[model samples]
Target: MDSRTMIASLPCLALVIVTLGYLGLCVVSPFGRCRACHATGRTRSRLGRIRRDCRHCAGTGLRLRVGRHVINHLHDEYEAAKR
Candidate 1:
């Protein structure tokens, strides 16, 4: 209720908001893609049809890159906390 109490609570409130926002970004970011054969628009042939191998990662792999903004934000927080 008083000015002193309100000021003391500001940091905790800000931390909560920041943590929630970071989690939201992580959940919404596309970190991975499906790996499967693309021939005939299916992974398998149900009736003895031809199936083409996946072209994105050559059917043996997939790559994921971290969301840069998220990583940078975390790094910044770490540096701030250390100081």
Candidate 2:
């Protein structure tokens, strides 16, 4: 392909590659460490003396990946529609 054509398609190719990689990640490992508590399931107080459950992950130390959540929602919708 000509350099011009190649350059034009670069963004699209990058997007597809990223999308596929995320899908693979979702399938291989659906849950990722929570961001709020750094996967420790708890947060420390300002004084570092008290700990509280991570509100974002509900103390599980893991949260559903976005891609996996979207996949799940789509599957649920498909099933409901199939009924």
Candidate 3:
């Protein structure tokens, strides 16, 4: 209503917007991992046998679907603009 009220609410507003955006992206996209280690981007075969990259994430911890990538790009742009 007033400037002070709006200023105090800015953080909450941003949080709500980000949360909704993330939820919408989650609904449209899905996550998958071929191995538990893939979720962490690397694999330790028996702790010391052999360490290797993840096939599921292709060495990245998080796997993004097609649309999810766009969402991520948008988020990055938003963050860049905010700064």
Model 1: ten consecutive residues of lowest lDDT: 34-43
lDDT of each: 0.60, 0.96, 0.75
**Candidate 2 Cα outliers beyond 4 Å, as residue runs:** 45-48
Error of 1 at 51 (Å): 32
Residue 33's C-alpha lDDT in candidate 3?
51
**What tens digits encode model 1's per-residue C-alpha lDDT throughout 1-83?**
99999999999999999977766665666344544532222344466575654555455444232454567688899999999
> How many backbone clashes can be found in candidate 1?
0
Could you give candidate 3's per-residue lDDT for residues 1-83 as a string of tens digits? 99999999999999999978876866665564545574778887667789888776778777766556667788999999999
Instruction: Compare candidates 1 and 2 on lDDT and give the better one.
Output: 2
**Greater-TM-score candidate between 1 and 2:** 2
Q: What C-alpha root-mean-square deviation, in Å, does candidate 1 show against the real structure?
A: 9.9
- On a 0 to 1 TM-score scale, where does candidate 2 land against the true structure? 0.85
Instruction: Please give the TM-score that candidate 3 achieves against the real structure.
Output: 0.46
Worst 10 residues of 3 by lDDT: 29-38
Pitting candidate 1 against candidate 3, the one with the higher TM-score is 3
Question: Ten residues in a row with the worst lDDT in model 2?
Answer: 44-53
